[model samples]
Target: MTSQFPNTLTPKMVEGIKGFNLCTFLIGLEGWRRGLTLKYYSDINQYSDIHTQGKKLMGRNYSLQSKDKIHYFNQSRGDMVSNEAVRIAQSKQKTKDYLEKGNVNILPSKEFDKTHSDVDIIKLAREIGYPVIIKPTYGSLSKGVMLNLKNDSELTDALKYVRGQLGYSNVILERYFEGADIRVYVVNNVAVAALRREPPKVTGDGESSIEKLINEKNESRKDNPYLAARPIKIDKELKDVLRKNNYKLSSILENGKTIMVKNKSTLTQGVDLYDITDTVPEHVKQLAIDTLNALPNIIHGSIDMLFDGEEAVVLEVNASANISMHMFPTEGQPRSIASFLMDFYFPETKGKSSNHTNMYFDFVDIVNTLKQNYTNYVEVKSLPQPPLYAKKYIVTGEVQNVGYRNWIRRQATKRELHGYTKNLKNGNVVVVVASHEKEKVDKFKRVCKKGSKKSKVSDVKSSDWTKEIKMGFEIKDNITKKKKEVDKKYINELLTELKETQTKLENAKKMQEELRMERDSYKDKLSSIRNSTSWRVTEPVRVIGGLLKGKTKVKN
Candidate 1:
């Protein structure tokens, strides 16, 4: 559509021709107020005057003669046209011109293509290449845009499926661009705000199962605007994607780990958006504007750009873009979109600039702070002298029943310190020692700090006694002397019994060796005797003759 301001005129004529007086053009008034200009107030009052007074600023010849008079020569509406054209130009790959200067305005009675088909879009993509985008021609936001189609088969399959489901054949197919998607809002030929959206994520707690967590998230989405409208449904698409990542709904998630469901950070999908305005360097802003200008028919529209590093590619533009912050507000406040519309209506009032000086931080406060707290600041100092006179301390906890007393005893013995430790009645350790070396005291303190593994130091009370102590360390007798006497007597008896048993065992071993030697000697002697007997003949008296003689004697 042609701008109310005529484009045929020279720069001088353009400047001389007045726009809608502040009162008549609502958008223009909005621009001035947002522009932070004092002239905006003057213009507002002037419009109010025209409503009340008969006088005119430029006399009656000017287009806006009175409050009711419409200024047909204004270019406020041209913003929408220029924005659309810039988008188209960028999508068509007009890089340099779009960057240098954004699209100015659309031609008179300009119209976008109302009907487009998947088949026609596919042809465009195939001409562009295998990878192209297929989206609805008349889509809201970025619905129905797909990427990375390698062949006609996939395209045909997708085309047939969407057409059957949505019952709309007018789908937009454009060349696919790979990179991070960006959203930038341009108001009245100037970029107002921009943001880079990140994909969705879920962090793991190491305890909850992914499916349980997803259910919880879905439940939460019932209250969250970003995820409320269309709850994230568990379907074949999500299942397939999850399966590809080796993720099962029942899988336990590790703590601090994040899982991403989709590639884009759209409210309809699962994704997170991190604001990048602070990090968006100067050059990037120019590139975005350039990308927008390439689209010839877009004015007052949002341009989505895909960027890898500094190299940006123009994505689809949204003509009737939703004031997105409704679904997701920016950092702090909900933006005043109505005011933005008012600015677009009043274009001429915004040209006047405000000269208010902004106050910033001063250095006097820094010096004052230093003076107040300078002594408290960190400073390097020499180490303090070590403790001069060493004192023995006995500290214990749940040490006795847990064999901690023995541990302490062994430690003291190893150190050759004069001290003895024993378990107390109330589960405390009582130790006494006389040591002068500072190093030993330090070492003992160190050991006390880390007590026995099973023991907890509930209290450690120490005192310096007035009574003179002996130098040599000894295991002092217990207050119950009878128990100590019994223990000592038992130990002596055990030692004596062990010695007697050991002597008897040695004697028995010696006798066994001696007997074995004697047996061996006898065997040799027997062998010699047997050899001598074999050599000699044997003539002996018969037992039968002796028996006959004995019988004869009996008979006599």
Candidate 2:
């Protein structure tokens, strides 16, 4: 089985696994947990090389020299999809052509270049009928897509926006189909999951204004992992959508009424996903599988369609990267598409099952790895080198007292590299790395330059030093005796200050208790005096004296 699939890894998978790219991380985590050795190169120094030779690294780019062959993945999509398949699927016009050729029911669409006049484009839409959709020829995540163009003015405006605003030279106009937006994820010509993507909407509560309702709806989505990053915006598009429904930002809607706020059903635009896998018709599943089979060398991807009653029309096919709708549907059982992908990559482990909780890599480990070596931008390419190499590095600038040593140690251990990271007296970090693979060593140096999240690394100087370092990596205690003495003095000073504070606190408590006792004694003495027989006898004499004084004053 190892000989059949072969071990593989991608740079994107390594760097992205540490960051917010959940799709890439899920696939990489699944592969790592399944016992496949993964290697990646994401240092800034290698960016130029990767950028220049990116095309050559496509489709089974490198083979891992493992004893057993294990299939590797790029992003979450495995080797099942080919470079050609991704290219064709990226273009809307090209995808429509292939679907039509496969006898699939796709909406009639016409491709137009920027040179086409508004008259020509509007004329084409008229022929296709009113309520046509205009979108960029090549795009994803529903960017630059306009729907429900019911007039020449609307079509003309959409063309300008797609061309002028979006800067897309090529655009496609298609007949608009009204139905529930559905997506079917297929793996190896088998439908594994289905989702119904509904446009972002807010239900009216009868009293609150439309804007207030939208705010409430967005607030509810703030805690969702997927929805938090992509909230509905009150932009021009949203305003237009509301206006079309005879509403505005200030409109107070009737109770139970719901209005769609966006034209396209994209998850990034707050679209809701409903898992319809079990309830989806067999014919619909077959159609999704057939759509993938229609494309050459495409075994895994999603088929987007519009379904009305029992009939479904193909909207588009995405092979470049699979959307994560199945993993976190808003209204249905969340599916583990990551596990499914791992099963496809490593077929030998299909029957072997583990606890569901153990299937994912540790989140803390992933975060630490990211903090050590991850950058916001990572390209999908490979580094040109053998499995093992060695290097020594001197990382300067804010590298001390920031947990940099522990971060580098964890990074080396995760990559199975032998290296030592220690703090120098000069406030620099020195690292000696030796790995069986050169890419691993390169990645280590890159991570050192980035340092931990708390450390600010100014520069990283590297040199070849395989001959000097021994096997296994450890953090060497290189602090001088003088520095240790200084540390001890600082600790003593803190201890003295703490003791003084404690004594002051105790003194304050004692004074408070004494004050309370003195006040209570005074109260007791006053009560005793008031209750005495002498006081009672003096009360009657005082009253007689007061009356005599009053009588003398009246006579005077």
Lowest summed lDDT across 10 adjacent residues in model 2 is found at 1-10
Cα RMSD (Å) between model 1 and the true structure? Answer: 36.9
Query: How badly does each model clash, as a count of residue pairs?
Result: 39, 7
Candidate 2 residue lDDT tens string, 225-324:
4555677888998998888878999999899998888888865687777788999999999999999988998888888888996789998887744444
Candidate 1, superposed: residue stretches over 4 Å from native: 1-130, 150-157, 218-227, 263-267, 291-299, 326-339, 346-556
Tens-digit lDDT track of model 1 for 1-556: 0011111111221122222221122232233223322111212223332221122222111122123323321222232354334333323223223433544221111111336555565566566676655655444435455555568987786676556565545555555566676766666566666666655456789999877777766675443333344444566546755797999878888998988655444545643433455465556666556555555545455556776776665554544344433223323232333244444645443432221001111112222333454432211111112122234556755666675666666676666554456556666676654344556755676565467778777656655532222222344424676886898899999999999998988988889889989998999888776577553433134456688899999999
Best by TM-score: 2
Candidates in order have lDDT scores of 0.47, 0.70
For model 2, state the Cα shift of residue 73 in Å.
2.6
Question: Which candidate tops lDDT?
Answer: 2
- Candidate 2: give the clashing pairs: 2-69, 6-70, 7-70, 387-436, 387-437, 388-436, 388-437
TM-scores for all candidates: the values are: 0.40, 0.60
Candidate 2 positional error at 120, Å: 1.2
